[model samples]
Target chain A: MSINEIQDSIIEDFSMYEDWADKYEFIIELGKELPAMNELYKIEENLIKGCQSRVWLHAHEEEGVLKFQADSDAIITKGIIGLLIKVFSGHTAQEIANTDIYFLKEIGLQEHLSPTRANGLVSMVKQIKNYAIAFNLKS
Target chain B: MGAITTGLNVQAIREDFPILKTLVHNKPLVYFDNAASTQKPKIVLDTEYHYYSSQYANIHRGVHYLSQIGTELYEKTRHIVKDFIGANSEREIIFTKGTTNSINLLAYSWSSAFLKPGDEILITGMEHHSNIVPWQLACQRHGATLKVVPLQEDGSINIDEVKNMISEKTRLFSFTYVSNALGTINPVKEMTAIAHQAGAHVLIDAAQAIQHIAINVQELNCDFLAFSGHKIYGPTGTGILYGKEALLDAMPPFEGGGDMIKDVKFEQTSFNELPFKFEAGTPNIAGTIALGTAIEYVEKIGLDNIFAYEEELLKYGTEQLQQINGLTIYGNSIHKSSVLSFLLDGAHPYDVGVILDHLGIAIRTGHHCTQPIMDYFCIPGTCRASIAFYNTKEEIDLLVTGIQRASKMLL
Candidate 1:
C-alpha cells in the first residue's frame, strides 16, 4: 500500500472511535503489538532525548527501500512511532522524503508531534526525514 | 455538592477560580499541577484588568496624578509582600521578575561583593535548577567552589551532612524550603541556625514554600529569602527578594539601568537607595499592583486555614494513592506539602501522563527541573499530582480514578 493509502486507512480506523479513551486504547494496542527493536540498536547514538520520555530510532536500507525500527519508553509515543513506521518503512528513500504526512491531525493526535509536547515524536519524524534525505543523497 | 471542611469553604474557593469550571476533552478539568503554577482567582484577574483599564502608568519617576496612583499601588504591594513573608521592613523587599530572577540578582550581587577564591557556596541535591544554576554561575565567576548536601533515601536532607559541610570558608549556604520534585519540607529554622553558627549567610529558596507554609524571615533569621508572586496566586513577572538591610546595603547593584541610579555624571554615577537600587529599569507596574490584590485575597482567607485544608487533602491523596498496587511514592518525609510523585511498575511517567491528560486530569511529568533527584532515585521521572487549597476531596477521587484508568490502559 502507498503511504497516503495507509494513513487514510488508519484515519478511517480512528474515526470509528467516538471517545478519546477508546482512541487511546487503540493506540495502546498498537504499541503492544509493535515488534521490539534489538537491544544492540538501543544505544546512546540512536537515542532521542526528550524532556518527558526517551526514544530510539534505527534505520537501514534494503535494496533501494528504507526500513526503520524505533521504540520509546512511553507507550503513546511508541504507538505513534508504529504508525510512522507503517507509513514510511517500506518506501524508497526518495519517495519517503517527498511524502507529506498529515494523518496525525486527522486522528486528533497532532499534539503528540508538537515541539512543546517534548515526547520525542517530533524529533522522531524529523529523524526519519533526515534518514531518507541522507540515503537519497547516497543513491 | 458545596461543602465546608476543615474550616475552609473549599467549594466557594473553587468557584473563585473560573478555570475550575472548564472542560477538557469533554470532561471537567482536574488541575493537579499547582506546583508548576496556580490558576488565578477571579479577583486577581479583575484587578489586573482593572489596573490596565483604569490606572496604568510608569511608577516612581512620574509626578503626574495617574503616576502617583500607580506608584502608590505598586509600593503597596512591596509593603504587603514584606508583611507576607514577615521581613523586618518594607525596604527589605526588592521586586524582581520571579524567583529565578531574584536568585540570579542575589547570586551576582552577593558573590561579587563577598565571594573570594576558594570560598564555598553550599546547596542541596534536591534544589530546582533555578536554585542550583545561579550559584554555579556565581561560583564560576568568583572562583568559588560549589558544595552539595546529598539527599537521604527518603528524599530528606541529613542535618549531620549540613553540619559537616559548613566551614569557615562557606560563604553562602542556600537551599530550598520545600523540594518541588519531591514534597519534602526541610527544617529551615534548624538549618538556618546551623549555617549561622559557621558565620555563613543563609538564603532560603521559598519559591515552593511561600504559598504552603507561613514564613518569617526575622524569626528564621535568614539573611535572604526568595519567592515568586505567581506561585502564590499573584501575577507572573512579580517576585520578592527579601534581604537584611545591612547585607543589601553592602552588595553592589545587579543591573545598571535608569531607575537604579541616583545621579549619572559624565565620569561617575551614584546608585539609588534600598529596594530601588536593586530594581533596575521600568518595572511591571500593573502586575505588581495586582500582586497586592492577590496577597489581600490570600490574607482574607488566611494562610493558616489554607495550610490546614491542603494538608488534609495531601493526607487523603497519599492514602488513596497508596492503595493502588504496583505503585511507588517518592518523598516519604514526615513533613511534606501537597505534592505526590509516583511511578507505576512498568509504565513510563510520560505514558501515564498522556493517558491521564485524555481523562481531563492535568499532572506534571518528568524530572520537574530537579534532575539530580531523578538521578538519585535511578528513574527517568515520576508523575506528580500537586494540590492547592481550592482542590477538594471529590477532585482527588476523580484523580484516583483517572490514575487507575491510566494504569489499566498503559501497564
Candidate 2:
C-alpha cells in the first residue's frame, strides 16, 4: 500500500474508537505488538534524547528501498513510532523522502509532533526524513 | 466544601483561582504541577491587569504621576518581601527575573568578590539545574573547585556528609531548601549553621520552599536566599534575592545599567545602593507590584495554615499512591513537602504522563531539571504530582484514579 493509504487506514482504525481511552488502548496494543529492534542497534549513536522520553532510530537501505527500525522507552511514543515505521518502511528512499506525513493530526496524536512535548517523536520523524534523504542522495 | 480540617476553606480558595474551573478534554482540570508553577489567583490576575491598565509606567526614571505610583507600588513589594522572609531590611530584598536569575546574580557578584583560586563551593546532588549551573560557572570563572553533598538512598542528604564536605577551603555552600524533584525538605537551619561554622557563605535556593513553608532569613541566618515569584502564585519574571546587608554591600554590581548606577562617566562610574546595585536595568515594574498583591493574598490565608493543609494532602496522596502495586516512590524523607514522585513497574513516565494528560490531570513527568536525582535512582524520570493549598482530597482521588487508569492502559 502507499504511504497515504496506510495513514488513512490507521486513521480509520483510530476512528473506530470515539473515546480517548480506547484510542490510547489501541496505541498501547500496537506498541506491544511492535517488533523490538536489535539490542546492538540501541546504541548511544542512534539515541535521540528528549526531556520526557528517549527514542532510538536505525535505518538501512537494500536494493534502493529503505527499511527503518525504531524504539522508545515510552509505550505511547513507541506506538507512534510503530505507525511511522509501518508507513515508511519497505518503500524506496526517494518515495519515503518525498512523502509529507499528516496522519498524526488525523489520528489525534498531533501533540507528539510539537517540539515542546519533548517525547522524541518529532526528532524521530526528523531522523527518518534525514535517513531517507541521505539514502536518496547515495542511490 | 467550605473548609477542611485545617480551616483553610479549600472551596473558597479554589474559587480564588479562576483557572480551577477550567476543563480539559471534556473533563475538569486537576492541576498537580504546583512545583512547576502555581496557577494565579484572580486577585493576582486582576492586579496585573489593573496595573497595566491604570498604573503602568517606567519606575524610578520618570516623574509622572503614574511613574510615581508604579515606583511606590514596586518599592512596597520590596518591603513586603523583606517582611515576608523576615529579612533585616528592605535593602536586603533584590528583585530579579526569577530564581535562576537571582542565583546567577549572586553567583557572579559573590564569586567575583569572595571566590579565590583553589577555593571550594559546595552544593547538593538534588539541586535544580538553576542552582547547579550558576555555581559551576562561578567555579569556572574564579578557578575554584565545586563539591557536592551526596543524597542518601531515600533522596535525603546526610548532615554528617555535609559537615564533612565543608572545610576552610569551602568559600561558599549553596543548596536548595526543598528538592524540586523529590520533595525532600532539607534541615536548612542545621545546614546553614554547619556552613557558617566552617566560615562559608551559604545560599538557600527557596524556589520550592517559599510557597510551602514559612521562612525567616534572620532566624535561618543564611547569607543569601532565592525564590521565584511564579511558584508562589505571583507573576513570572519576578523573584526575590534576600541577602545580608553587609554581604550585598560588599559585592560588586552584577550588571552595569541605568538604575544600578549612581553616576557614570567614560572614565569612571559609581554603583548605586545595595538592592538597586544588584537589580540593574529597568525592572518588571507591573509584575513587582502584583507580586506584592500575591504576597498579601498568601499572608491573608497564612503560610502556617497552607503548610498544614498541604501536608495533609501530601500524606493522603502518599498513602493512596502506596496502595498501587508495582509503584515505587522516591524521596521517602519524613520531612517532605507536597511533591510526590513515583514510577510504575514496566511503564515509562512519559507513557503514564500522556495517559494522565488525556484524563485532564496535569502532572510533571521528567527529570524535573534535577538530572542528578534521576541518575542517583538509576531511572530516566518519574511522574510528579505536587499539591497546593487549593487542591483538595477529591482532586487527589481523581489523580489516583487517573494513575490507575494509566497503569491499566499502558501495562
RMSD of each: 1.4, 1.3
- In lDDT terms, how accurate is model 2? 0.92
- Using Cα atoms, each model's DockQ against the true complex is 0.87, 0.91
Off by over 4 Å in 1: B1-5
Model 2 docking category: high
Kept native contacts, fraction for each prediction: 0.88, 0.92
Candidate 1 per-residue C-alpha lDDT over B1-411 given as tens digits, one digit per residue, 9 for 90 to 100: 334368998878888999999999788999999999988999999998998899888889799988999999999998888888888888899999999999999999999899999999999989999999999998999899999999999989999999999999999999999999999999999999999999999999999898898888999999999999899998899988999999999999999999999999989999999989998899988888888888889899998998999998999999989998889999999999989999989999998998888888999999999999999999999999999998988988998888889888887
Error of 1 at B396 (Å): 0.9
Give the Å error, residue B137, model 2: 1.3
The worst-scoring run of ten residues by lDDT in candidate 1 chain A lies at: A19-28
Docking class of 1: high
Question: Candidate 2 on A76-132: residue-level lDDT in tens?
Answer: 999888999999999988888899998999978898899999988889898988998
lDDT tens digits by residue: candidate 1, A1-139: 8889999998998989988888888898899989999999999999999888899999999977999999998888899989999999989888889999899999999999999999998898999999999999988
Q: Which stretches of candidate 2 lie over 4 Å from their true place?
A: B1-3
